[model samples]
Target: MIYKVFYQEAKDSTPRREQTRALYLDIDAQTELEGRIIARQLVEEHTAYNIEFIELLSENHLEYEKTHADFSITEF
Candidate 1:
């Protein structure tokens, strides 16, 4: 299953308060719990702040379509 995790980070000066910047990650896992765990681990390793929210966007099909769009070139 593929999950889209949405997370918000805090500012350097204020760790408690959230900053304007946000991160969106697409993760593959068997379950929602696993996805959340992966998201937490990624945030811990990569970012200084904790994740504010973690959600499952879609199961499998839609995620791929959204991430990889179909494109074509037409000669004029």
Candidate 2:
């Protein structure tokens, strides 16, 4: 399954309306728990980010792909 993670830089406050979107990430994992874990690990290792939420995308993956021109599955 694919999980979409919305996050913001740890040093930054909540984004304003004009922010468009928080830094976006899509991770492929066997389950929701695994997806969350990997996302956290990647963020912790690469940059400081506060995860806003995680959404399961396997159901809406097609729509997501069409909507986000830069969509990709993040590697852990």
Candidate 3:
């Protein structure tokens, strides 16, 4: 499944809504808890951002993407 991992610059202060950043990962996990743990490790290996939250791709995620046209996934 795909996970949207919210994060922000580790060296910067906590950001406001507009300043938040995100990265997408395809995690092969079953539950939210499991996905979260995998998401953290993936982020750590690829970036220096402090994780804010991890969102699994479900019904709500699809709606969010529709509403925010700029939402994207990076293929590595």
Candidate 4:
């Protein structure tokens, strides 16, 4: 299955730190559930760094567009 990971920069106002990246990943996996798990694990591993995960509920064209308008509007 194919998976898309959307990440956003995280800022720690209290600590006065910021990360300079807005991350997005496209991955192919054997299963959707496994893909999500893998994405979760990646976010967990990067917790120490200034990284934040923005979960994608569905990869469906319509749904994905509703969630993110930055991507092309046409069906995927």
Clash pairs (backbone) in predicted model 3: none
Error of 3 at 9 (Å): 2.2
Q: Give all candidates' CA lDDT scores.
A: 0.55, 0.64, 0.77, 0.47
* Model 4 ranges off by over 4 Å: 1-23, 48-68, 71-76
Can you tell me which runs of candidate 2 are displaced by over 4 Å?
20-30, 67-69
Give the C-alpha lDDT of model 4.
0.47
Model 3, 41: alpha-carbon shift in Å?
Answer: 0.8
TM-score quality measure for candidate 4:
0.38
List runs of model 1 lying over 4 Å from the truth: 1-8, 11-20, 59-76
3 versus 4: better TM-score goes to: 3
- Estimate the TM-score of every prediction: 0.52, 0.59, 0.73, 0.38
lDDT of 3 by residue, 2-71 (tens): 7888887773676667778877777778888898898888788777788888888787776777588566
Q: What is the full ranking by TM-score, best candidate first?
A: 3, 2, 1, 4
Give the local distance difference test score of model 3: 0.77
Tens-place lDDT digits, model 4, residues 1-76: 3334444344443333253433344445677676677765665576543434434445575466546655431111
Residues 1-76 of candidate 1: C-alpha lDDT, one tens digit per residue: 4343344464345434334334455666778898779877877776666456665655464556466644121111
Best by lDDT: 3
lDDT of 2 by residue, 29-59 (tens): 7877887788778767887666667666665
